[model samples]
Target: MRFKLQTDYALRALVYMAAKQGENCTTDEIAGYFQISAAHLGRVIRRLQNHGYVKAIRGRRGGVRLDRDPESVNLGEVVEVLEEGAQPLDPPTGEPGNGVDDALRLKAVLRRAHGLFVNYLNKVTLAELVAEGLPEPQPAQQPSEESAPAEPQPTVAAEPEVASSPEKTPEPVGAPSAAPGYGRPGSPTYGGY
Candidate 1:
């Protein structure tokens, strides 16, 4: 359910590049703006270059720029490229056919859900995200005290205090132990004889 910080940085870096279309962007510039590590941004830029999302130029005035138009770049595709082998959920693993079928079933359901999420994302392009003419933020209005709902107070339960007296520790494995009353050898309540 959580994206890696690298993914977030990749998106930011791409956005910055897209916004500065026609202008070459340096790793130091992107890193400085985003407050990220320059070395890390360099790695990200290199990966993007390898993936054809960006083109790097060399020279005193050279830097990196987007290879494609912002409108043509799909956010979902970019995310996929950046997170090549990432899975939102871990694969299910447990003893087979021993009441573990439910866990496997849940895993399948979650996988399907994640697929649907990605499918929705695929429909959105980066152009939509970086579009100009965004709606302005509305000013917040102070609510009258009489009209405002009272904040709910959280209830905290007191925890039972443990005595400081030292208790007897259980016998270690392979050590001998006395049997308890009314229990057969190897019973669940007592250690095995």
Candidate 2:
């Protein structure tokens, strides 16, 4: 299911703050980095501030900082808070039968699916989201001036190492080859493709 733009912005801002390690950041800074409108981000920040997830400071050298620990911020809870009153499927109305029952059943299934989705999100925390270091900012490249050519260094060729058994190489016991957050090979959740 798709989330509202404001919900998406709120999550992005939180992730940025989490990666910043408690450093205060301005809305303009975040908006500029994300290439979004500062005014829209400001509204999202205000909502976050009202929810006590972010604290806004006033005056000089003022900015917003995360008010709570990253570990305490559950992704599901954040989504729920930011998406309050948002209905994924409209409630079925009118008398029973005549396709109304089918709509009601579909709504129920959607509700259950949404609950499962949120449950999965609950397993993830803000800290986990930012456990990896932030991406390095790219600097603008400058044009190089024409200069004298330099000689290239000499290269050495090496033979590739060969396994003792050509048919198959032995893998370490209990070693995980799959990426994190994904099911292991042979598991039900594993996407073999």
In order, the Cα lDDT scores of the candidates are 0.66, 0.73
- Report the error of model 2 at residue 84, Å: 0.7
Count the clashes in each prediction: 0, 0
- Cα deviation of 74, candidate 1, in Å: 0.9
Clashing residue pairs in candidate 2 (N, C-alpha, C atoms within 3 angstroms):
none
Runs in model 1 lying further than 4 Å from the true structure: 97-99, 132-193
Candidate 1 per-residue lDDT, tens place, 1-193, comes to 4455566567667767787876898999887775667787798788888888889989999999888888888867877787785775676577888747887788788888878867775886556555542112221122353258659766554444554777655554444235422112333222110
Quickly count the clashes in candidate 1. Answer: 0
Which tens-of-lDDT digit does each residue in 1-193 have in candidate 2? 6667788678778878888887889999887776666798899999999999999988788899889999999988999998894666988888897889999999989988898978887887778767743322322121131133446655544444567768655444454553443223434333221
lDDT, model 2: 0.73
